[model samples]
Target: MGFPRWSRLGSDLRRAPGRVRARVTTARGRGGPSRRRSRTSHADPPRGGSCRPGRVGSRPHLRRHPRGHRGGHLLSTARSGDSGGECPLHRAAGARDISRCATSPPRHREAGGVRSLVRQPSRAFVSVRRFIAFGVAIVVIFSTLTARLYDLEIVRGDYYHQLSEQNRIVRLPVPAERGGIVDRNGYVLARNIPGFAISVIPVDLSRTREDELSQRLAALLDLPSDAIGDVIRAQRIRNPYEPVRISKTPVPREIALVVTERAELFPGVRVDPESIRFYVDGTLYAPVIGYTGPITEQELAKLKDSGYLPDDDVGRTGIEDVYEQFLRGTYGWREIERDAAQREIKTLALQRATVGNTVSLTIDDRLQKLLDAELRKGVDEDKFTQAVGVAINPQNGEILAMVSIPGYDNNMFARGISTAELAALNADDRHPLVNKAIGDRYPAGSTFKMVTGLSALSAGTATRDTVVNVSASSFSVSGTTFYDWRAHGSLDFVHGFAHSSDIYFYTLAAGTPFAPNVHGVGPDAIAKYARMLGFGAPTGIDLPGEDGGIMPDPQWKIATFDEPWTIGNTYQEAIGQGFVAVTPLQLLNAYASVANGGTLWQPHLLKQVTDAAGKTLPIPQWTSQKLDMTQENLRLIREAARRVVTIGHAYMPNLKIPIAGKTGTAEFGASAGKDSAGRNKLGFHNWFVSFVPQADNTDPTAQIAMAIFTYDSSKSLCELCLNPAVGMTQRILEQYLGPNK
Candidate 1:
């Protein structure tokens, strides 16, 4: 039979039969048995053409091929001119040249019948492969999601759960009542009174309710509606859920009752019980008891760790401040469960607050009142700028009574004083805030004469009988005339101290031309004895802000003024003038030392501290030191001090109880006018330091030392005007001593 024309194309396809056979074998392995059958028979090539799966039927089923076998069959078909049928590559290549027809294998041409070797894959095979691939992708996606689920639900479940619970919980602070302060006699000085304070919870109120609530609160609190609204808005920005204090001022009992009864009308409003500080005799005890005020930002920074809140009140000065740790009670808190709208569902837990400790001061209430009255009287009568009085028990250094005239009421601070009132107080020149008894400094004046006399006796420069003649009222030293208020022709140590003879003391401090005269004790011994008696240093009183008086010496003069110490300086110091200054407490303590025969006691105000349960706590013990004075010198000095009251200008002739005291008239300020001989007239600072019971008494507890200080600006130098401190001292003594027999 003759060969068909299509048989010629089979010859061309058979040219690359080895390559085609290899590709067919690879496709079969990848597809397995099912894929092999489908690829071979279902999509077989017809005659001399290559068959490719239809692009439009389904997505191409990717079969894994060996490293370099991909598209090998297609490349072979493109190279062969006879592709058995119209191959895709032949069409892409345009018309095939008939010149290559002679190159066909004769064996291929000899065969008239041609077989289709390549097959077209069925749509079912493509669909099955696509479904299998999609199923694998779904399995991979599910496996990844399961891992994430395990991590979120099991690995960190507790941490996330706690965060969820926090959103439903709220904490609130409970303020503790501050402690009470009392006098040694069990009289309450500071206490708290129960009252009501208005607070607003911002989270519990809506915008519309806020305006209504503000108006209601303003009517009840006597505040402007806008002010209440502003406060609520500002507090909401800081803490939306916490209670904001609308008014800390204590509402009247009736008003509080009304608020509580009508609670339904005022949403988010609360009237909570609060303690307000009260002072029984606030003005009288202000200096010693101090006052309480709202915590300042500076104080809050320091005390915040100790449970202090920003709105809490704290002690600002005096004993209240010094013992703040014990007086400010520990605050407690409550944990409550709340709903989404921040309404309290239930209290989960609560910690109760502890009360503060009680402080008992050594001040005698009656005596304090008496002294305050007397000092105030003196200040009023004398037209004095300022005055301070202090009384101490010589035996134990207990401050029996202390008074600073023009004292302020501590209740003002407790109740909250306005800025204008505070400014007025600060503007006052008298300095009402200062505890002048211990904080103010003044010249020891002639009260220091005792120290000079004692020093002379201790140094053996003079004895009780050592005499100096005061023929002239004034004695000259380095051309500076040291004048005596009055002259005595001649006087011994006891008599000179009794008369407060300036010339006599100047002779002892600086040498003079007198019969039986001795060398002066000099500024060294004077300052030595003064300092040994607690002068030129703080008295170590329990109170804060004590001034250490100045005791000037040769070195001090050189250091302070770059001037050499002269006889004039020594003379001035001998009579407690010049640079010999001392606080009233220091003077009182020094006299106490002399009265007790040499022991200098550390003055104190606090006597005891007790807890809320009434258990006594350990307190600072009484401290004292024996001075450098010998028994003989103390006796002589004590006798002279006794004579100062008995026979000198300080004498209280009407009193029966024996008292010893020294009077001083310290010169200060500019010399207003010179005398006819060019002598300068000076102003005076009056001073008096004394103690009850003569030095001969052995009972330490019976001895009481005191100091009175006042200023005099009068240039006339009248004895009465310059000696108001002496009269005030006598009045205090009379009140303390009673009718003596």
Candidate 2:
């Protein structure tokens, strides 16, 4: 009861923070040895008893000391059960019987001097496992941190480094300069001029101040504020990152200076150097060269992968459209380092732009001018609003000059045509926007008679010696009568061809009751010869939008009108009067075949091409085909055509240089209203096509063949009508052809 159990006491004290040793000394008493003996204390070691605190040596055997104490023997001052006697060690262990005490101690020890508490396995700890857990936790935490550092710095370093650079680096596009167009004689037809364009960044302009920005830009551009706002709004909806081009064309220098000099006033506006297209003699050569315009949203969607941007300009028509792939050069870019605010600090790398290829046309500017002037003269003198003229070399079908009156200026389109200007062009009655040379179709008139005449020659139905009874003004077939312009009396085939006798050709096309029994060449034979000489189809010229004019046969007529083909239709088609149409280029090439020993070549405008480095490039291969007519028949046709200019209605035999030609007058307006006299009130289309010989007619392919067509002339086919088309073409040929050649 005086001390703790020996096993637990030793462990508990040794695990404490400090070593403990306890001692007790006898005190000096007044009564010598008796007092000293009474103070001495000894008892057996206690079992099944609690130690008492702070009452040392009252009733005890021996007490263990706690940690951090030295020179001490512990004791208790508690009274024993049923015994109140005082005892130095349980009051009776010193002399009396200790059976009165409830518990007895195991072994007793007496300490005369100081005693120390030093138990075995001395290690300082209340709980050693908790400290071990803390040490392991520290080691694990440090190991995890080291492994994470290895993964970050070594495994994925390059990838994150590239990402860091990309956040500060950007690439900007560099547009290439468009190419120039020249004529065969090196005359500049189209080129590019340095200019500036205005652009606006939608994100740069504050949403609340967008209206003010639009108003300011409208004042400078002379455009509606609402229109400018619409453009900005559209760009913001599409993409907030890209800049939108404010001006579709080049901005004036004065306006560009205002945007660049006063940057604060225009927050989103920027000036960029943009090349503007310049076309020399735009009006004169509009149909041949064509124009360009800015790319639309729909076009950009299709061409985004092809390096085309929203601000790029694209070819619209003619050669510009036909050769667009070559003319549109590849774009370049500049890699630049930028700051956090996205302002470029320095150029990191750059790729230079490659300019577009240079294009040279086969057109002779001088001849083109001549053809244009001559057609203008015809329009004024003949009182017509529309006309077409085309001249080509008979040898290889290279077009020398082509003109379509009521033509528009290509420069206006290149400069961004306004809504009103474009509407006016589309609304004009004469059609200034249409290219009549190749896009429009008309009756070949008597110009088509050569096709029928050749068909009859090949069929052997009518020969040069064959005669037709053209004394009658009209020829009757299938109860439907077809009339000629007038009766030429009785005539031979060659003489009938020279005078353009419709009755003579009709008799050969569909047999009539004539002398020597002229046989009829069926409708298929006529169509065959028509197609053979480049009629009834497009010539596949280098220009865009060519019409394959109508060539009606029995099958075609049944498919179109759902009616049976009558012989009367054959008679009408024989003279190029009904269901027979051709483009101006197709008509000219038809005659070119006859004059050039029966070779009908494909027409082309591009002569050659060169790149930016002055190296020649391969040109596109244009399709060509030769006519299927014999040389003997070609000679016969040439002689008869020469007679048309010498002794027929063309009538131009006085010149030293020789030429051959034919004149035609085609009737139209079957659907027109009646006149004051209650007549059907038909309109006539006048035409004259010719070919010029060199010094001699021996070199036939070296000649130049031309065609002139005037639309809706009142006096084009009247009594004693001079045929203004013939006059215009004859003048052009006289000036264009030389005697020495």
Q: Which candidate comes out best when scored by TM-score?
A: 2
Overall local distance difference test of candidate 1: 0.74
Compose the digit string of candidate 1's lDDT tens values, residues 1-741. Answer: 122344444454465453232112111122222111112234344323332332223444332221233443332222222233322332433333211121122332233222234444656788999999999999999999998888877997788778768868867787888888888898888999877778888877887888888999887766688989999999789878778888745555676787889988788777888887888998898888888877879988998888889888887888888888778888888999988766689999999988888988888887788778877786787676677788898888999888887779998887657566799999998799999887888887788888889898989899988888888876565576667776688799889998888888887887776644489899999889889999999988877788998989999999999999888788889988888888889888988988887899999988888887889988878788999778888877777887888788787768656777888877677565886678887766778888887434433334678887776534545653347776677777777676640
**Which segments of candidate 1 are over 4 A away from where they belong?**
1-153, 163-171, 196-198, 204-234, 246-271, 514-516, 670-682, 694-701, 713-715, 720-722, 739-741
lDDT of 2 at 196: 86
- Report the lDDT tens digits of candidate 2 across residue range 1-741: 233344543453354334334222122223331111112233311232222222333544455333222345454544332232233334424423232222222122221111222333324352576789898999999999988877777888787778778868988888998888888888999888877888888878888888999999887776688988999999889865557878787865676898889999898887988888889898998988899888889999998999998788998998788888878887889999977655679999999888899899889888888889978876887567688989898888889888999899998887667677888999998888778989998887887889899998988887888888777777565577777768788888778988888888878888776554877898999999898887778898988899999998999999999999888888879888789988989989988878888777889898889998899999877666666667777888888888887788778756655778788888876434566678676777888888887744534754578888888754324532577787777677767665432
Best-fitting candidate, scored by lDDT: 2
Give residue 434's lDDT in candidate 2 (0 to 100): 79
How many clashes show up per model?
13, 16
Cα lDDT of candidate 2 equals 0.75
What Cα-based lDDT does every candidate model obtain?
Answer: 0.74, 0.75
